[model samples]
Target chain A: MQHKPIHIIIVDDHPMVIEGLKTLLSDDKRVLIKNQFMNGTDTLTYLEHNSADIVLLDVNLPDINGVEMVPKILNIRANIGVIGLSTYSEPSIINQMIKKGVKGYLLKNVTGEELVNAITQVHQGDFYFGSEVQKILADSVTQESNDQPKLTRREKHILTLIAEGKTTNNIAEELFISPLTVETHRRNLMQKLEVPNAASLIKVAVEKHLI
Target chain B: MQHKPIHIIIVDDHPMVIEGLKTLLSDDKRVLIKNQFMNGTDTLTYLEHNSADIVLLDVNLPDINGVEMVPKILNIRANIGVIGLSTYSEPSIINQMIKKGVKGYLLKNVTGEELVNAITQVHQGDFYFGSEVQKILADSVTQESNDQPKLTRREKHILTLIAEGKTTNNIAEELFISPLTVETHRRNLMQKLEVPNAASLIKVAVEKHLI
Candidate 1:
């Protein structure tokens, strides 16, 4: 029985680097290199005719940027995942890629094994961050986490429901509580958050990953 | 004196599409087509040796989804802008692109004039969203904005400083207010957001974009 192959395309401008990647990745039968490109334009063109499981793209392209191609590529095929391969460990780039919905990011200096692992992780729909990238993300999280507020159980429950897009009346009904109680909880939340409306509440929930 | 031509590359699998794009863009003496490729691999490879000011990429490529390519291209060139060309308008894709720092997105069916405008805007470090895209983004903003919290001005200012990593003492010092007042503001913010700790407070702040 043949196993399903993970089709991949390596997009970079260097022939030597491409050849090295191919050689390093050659032994894995499950990973097949579908095609290669030297720039963003050609990759976009090829994508019109073909599809792959993953794309390993360098950020610095000769004619265009790799980061900018993400949306256009996804518009063509929503299912394909991209793993940003880069030489620099810039925080801005890492943050941008995460926001862009990249499944994984690997430094160009990573070992072949790590690269393969990153591709597989992304294919499985899990997020993967390089070691350096993780530190960058953690720094932000740490600074922010220090001051996090504690939630009362009732408030926590209310916030959860709110994040789930529940109406106040619905929450009251579900909790077998008075509408006034729900209102009080909401009021408390507003005072604590100093926000003015439900939209901001939801926004905060999403940002803090409270939901 | 003649202005320097903006270097460009077109990457798509369709020869006809490449030709059409070239013809349309070439009319401007300020634009130059450095090369064209049918795949991401070659485009990436060529970028190693050459450089361009912009890359006009199709959202769909036969090898990989275009959305996935944005960060990959950006990793290679920090300065080169990208204009994503797509046939559809997807909220997630657009949101993803924005996070990845794409300069602009253009539907494939857009007018040549619009395309020209998109490139120019992206090259100048401004953002361009096609008309339909603008509506989608506006809708998201509207939806998000509706959740605005009803915090007092003092609460809002305190929340802002808190989100920016200010301590109660620091905030009080900056505002020329008592630390007790800052704590009161913070406590009020927590009650409003319904989060119990400083960590959750910042989280809510980020979610609501209150900061």
Candidate 2:
């Protein structure tokens, strides 16, 4: 008895990427290309009626953010495996996608064999991460253990303004918040980031890519 | 009459990258894979005895820095085109490579066709930068035109220290420069960044990725 070929869908904004991936995976007999979509909306629309064994999803999409669309895709068909693909190796984005139920993460430069293996593994309920991705994830874990603070959206907004040397009044006015509230947020940021004052806070924040 | 096929060399540390690129370009009749190397030393050694029309050089190498190796490679064969390939799209790194005489820059995620086009274009003495790379270059130019101050190495060092909330004395001791000299550098940084005070200076520097 022969097993059915794994059907895979490619979703990326770059036509070149779709073409390249298709060409790379064409030689693999175990995999079959179902369709390619240039954005998240088209992929979602197609997936509403159709399904694939795996989805090669680009992290940055034109219409919908790929991470944001992961859950939606799973909602459509929870059994479909997703493997994040992108040029970026940012731990934050990778972790976000993993948290949202992606089965694997691969960089855009992935080898054809690696790509096929990741798709196959994810389809079989195994997790896969490119070597570079694994390194980034490892580094992020270490950084987190070292007390890297996770800032909320509002906190991050205020931090950007603060890094721009905006005064409390300036930030409060720009963000439409009370000066007292801004101060409280500022205090929280400093404490969370483990900085003594504004200067060190900005320095650490920039170093950590918080702004 | 038949023209010579464009001989190309691949110099990337990853075995997968070398194999993937070779596989992708195998079908292209216009190009021939002359050699492959895992590091800069082997590539330089191979180039010293032989020559190729193009070298798909990785920016980061285990033995020698790819950017630093560009001029050396050209020195070996001045007509040979060097294209910097990497996952990074940092404006500073790209500009440095371009300034050092690379004919093109490509992201590692480049499609087989784009890869072929880049090699061919560079071999023909034209320049090529991937779309993402082009955007970065354009953004850098715009930032420069917007009165963005270009800081020297010493100035940037001082600015980082300032952002970290270090005083003149601390910076002076750390850098082995006199307090007066550190103060001068600090003043110069503020003026160049077009900010009136230390806080604003740090803010702008962080915002611009100067730190």
Candidate 3:
């Protein structure tokens, strides 16, 4: 079960984060702190002549952006598994980092045990996103693909008026249109939005953010 | 200056966080961790008879919310200084914690040095909000008090139309209102929003999230 320790370089702008990670991973003896950097430029410079098994990269760096640093790091050392470390788990940023080729992502509040687990898993060439990250990813997918029903400009205006509890006659008077035309628009809105009545139409419109 | 160690108890559900905190503060002789709890209920029970100078409380607890735990802990021990800790520094949550009588606030990514400073300051009856926290507080203040100009329903609708680059006549045709009435609405939008022209109106409207 024993093997050579996973040499990992910590790339973060915060000194305490590096120290904390070093302290957290120290006792395990499975991962060794090969080096540390305060910014992306220095980390990339260090990586040019040296090599490590993994790079624990931070999202915020003074010299270089974390998302951009991933491909650059891989461009220099393709075998080094890059695990992103950040204080926040923004879905767009995580997705961008993944697209640029990070092996794992972790929130900075990571426990010592999970840090070691992530390092071990990534060292084994398997992708690992922490539980919170996975949850955020799942939430983003559900939220983005929620199928927001589209409505036209006039339909949107009518929807807003309907949400305001306007009668068809009142809406016709306000828009200077015939009451029959207003009722037709209302019926079209219900059909387009797949709702049964005015109440459901307004509810679905709000849910889909059409108004 | 040598003095009696500040007896403190940590309330966090994560064991590794407790261990990491213990490791961080162990080197400092000025503080002593009396005990640790995985939830708020046990911490409160422990404080019923036993006393600690401070409680390093996490925001998320299985049994009790971190903000609610503050007053509860102080109900049992009024003199205990509670320092709120969390992975994220949500402005409203931080503001609520402050309003609830937390003496200090620190992000869980706190450095050992800042952590000791927070404990010492809170122990001495002074407030200590970490630098990142101060920035977020400042941002929330600027964001909330930005003096958003409230617009009525029709005004908001006109604002959206203007943002879509619709001319006064075009909007008049669409809304079935006279061009002169549309012109008055456009001018009213500019004056009410305090912008000089349509471009500025759209810019401010977007900034204020009116459209």
DockQ for each model: 0.05, 0.27, 0.10
lDDT of 1 at B147: 49
Best by TM-score: 2
Structural similarity of chain A in candidate 1, as TM-score: 0.65
Number of clashing residue pairs in every model? Answer: 119, 0, 0
lDDT of 1 by residue, B1-211 (tens): 9978888877775443565566567568777888887778787778877888898887667676676677778788778887777645666567667777778887654655776787777777888888978897788777653344678988988877765556788889999999998898888888887776665666556655466
Best by lDDT: 2
Please write out the lDDT profile of model 1 over residues A1-211, one tens digit for every residue.
9969899998876543565567667778879999998899899888988989998887777788766877767888888898887755665566666667678887755666777788788888887877867886788666543223556889878987775556779889999999889999988876665566654564555544345
What is the clash tally of candidate 1? 119
Once fitted onto the true fold, the runs of candidate 2 whose alpha carbons sit more than 4 angstroms away are: A12-28, A86-89, A107-117, A130-139, A142-154, A169-184, A203-209, B12-28, B60-63, B86-89, B106-118, B129-139, B145-185, B192-211
Model 3, range B1-211, lDDT digits (tens) per residue?
A: 7899999999887655677688789899999999999888899899998999999999988889997999999999999999999876577778879889999999866888999999999999999999999998899798774445667888888777765546778789999999999899888888887755664465455545456
Candidate 2, A121-156: lDDT as tens digits: 998899999898999899989867433478999999
lDDT of each: 0.73, 0.84, 0.83
Question: Each prediction's Cα RMSD?
Answer: 14.2, 4.3, 12.1
State which candidate has the highest DockQ. Answer: 2
Q: Look at candidate 2 and give me any clashing residue pairs.
A: none
Candidate 2 TM-score for chain A: 0.86
RMSD of 3: 12.1
Q: Flag regions of model 3 displaced more than 4 Å.
A: A13-16, A60-64, A86-91, A107-111, A131-211, B13-19, B60-63, B86-91, B108-110, B131-211
Worst 10 residues of 1 chain A by lDDT: A142-151
